[model samples]
Target: MSYSPTIYKFADGGGAPVAPEMALVRAVLEPHDVGDPQLTVGEDGSLRFWIRASDDSEAEISADETGILVERPQTGGVFAIVAELVTKLGAVIIDPASGRAVCRAEEQTRLPADMREEAIVIDMTGDALEAALLGPRIAVGPSPRAAR
Candidate 1:
């Protein structure tokens, strides 16, 4: 069976499509002990994951061609996880507020100067997830009774 996130739409009636990039993002996030991860697609084709940022606050990480967008009521603890994801995906975090690359300075060079000023760009292609989909499959040999 394949993994697909439950789809949802914004109040504005816009929603994103299910894309392979989301699977890659989920693959990168699966091993973490972070709160139960919930994936959602936005109207603009952005994939987002929701998690608890704190006892009282919620956070969301949205990924698109531009990169990932980290949104939280408070960025304190959530930023660490965002940073880790940036590193794992060979991407960079861009602070939308300041319009600057805030983490993974080395990866900043990968994005065009214009995009660097916008979204947090995770430098991953859908190809990054090709391996995850190729899990080992069991061969269906003849049933025991049939063999007998």
Candidate 2:
């Protein structure tokens, strides 16, 4: 019941964003099975979506500049969003605390092992990105749920 937005930056290049942005939401359901849908933004700036049962864990999914590519992973359970054009240069982590979600940039520019408890939230853009790119500080904002 929480939404965290995190912005990732490309290390080598510093221009137009060529990386895909992903947002995952989870909800409780019956034993029959039900899971939250995944949200993805392609490099070309297109929206892609998918729905899967909570029981089906492995679902192969790719969200790149072209769009969304749906496939079932051989491993089974847990869908993997492929980064074709965007290399996922870096990632941010956002956590819900009190009434706000704290957004923090990765210390090493990679997705950490613990993503559930520590996720990333993207709350700033344009000038905000400029400032963050300079100092690399955490962004705090009202929870997307609370904003409404």
Candidate 3:
């Protein structure tokens, strides 16, 4: 995980914020606001939060006047948090690395074809393993395990 955070903000119309300062703060903090936290305020006045991603994993989630940050993520799983902010503030994500739009469906589909095939082999998200395992690009067939 990089020390840098994955930011969420409006891509254009930069004069005013997407929402009121307080509402932006509330929207980002409210969901993760449970329990006491040793919050810190940066020189820029941004607030940082520490969150538990799982029993064995922990993460930092933060909010500021400009936008929110999901910092040092291991996987893109945490990107789901941006969905609410997108709806609430009408904000779009800027990929920290690419500096381009992040929330669009096309971004998700840009994975290489070989990786998509590996996903089928590993049963990552889609249910095409039954077909993928049968042969190259075959249509889905009954799972061999289903016969058991």
Candidate 4:
């Protein structure tokens, strides 16, 4: 089953732009060293890194002037690692599910309706991630058994 990966944004206090440095990100992930880390910096000054778990699951994190973006296949505990890095960066975790930002208490705001349907929506404020994780599976179509 294919599931939309959850998105987590990181920001500093006072809503300042914070770019997660590659060095720091590497250091933070050293302990969980799965293998050689793949890091790249885009022309737009965005930093991206990919780390593969021993189980072959991979997690990718990208950070730009706006904030850090985390994407993982499914709830394979990769977020826990991302969460730790967020805490280390001293940045706030904006969980879209709660309607309010986490890591630093803030007012609740709902993402625009259009963004809510997009595969990779940027505006974070809800528990869509958690809900997807806990919610029932969505059947893509008729099962093979049914077809038979």
Error of 1 at 116 (Å): 8.8
For 14-36, candidate 4 gives per-residue lDDT tens digits of 33434556566666666655544
Q: Rate the local accuracy (lDDT) of all candidates.
A: 0.43, 0.32, 0.43, 0.48
RMSD of each: 16.8, 15.1, 10.9, 8.2
- Descending-lDDT candidate ranking: 4, 3, 1, 2
Highest lDDT: give the candidate number.
4
Candidate 3 lDDT, 48-136, residue by residue in tens: 66543323234466666666666663333233343444445544444455343333333223333332222212222212211222223
- Name the runs in model 1 displaced over 4 angstroms: 1-21, 30-46, 53-57, 113-148
Q: Per model, how many backbone clashes are there?
A: 4, 14, 0, 5
Model 4 has an lDDT value of: 0.48
TM-score of 3: 0.46
Candidate 1 lDDT over residue span 81-111, tens digit each: 4444545665444333344443333554555
Give the CA lDDT, 0 to 100, for residue 45 in model 4.
Answer: 64
| Segments in model 4 whose C-alpha atoms lie over 4 Å from true places | 1-13, 29-39, 104-148
Scored by lDDT, model 2 comes in at 0.32
Candidate 2 lDDT score at position 121: 41
Clashes of 2: 14
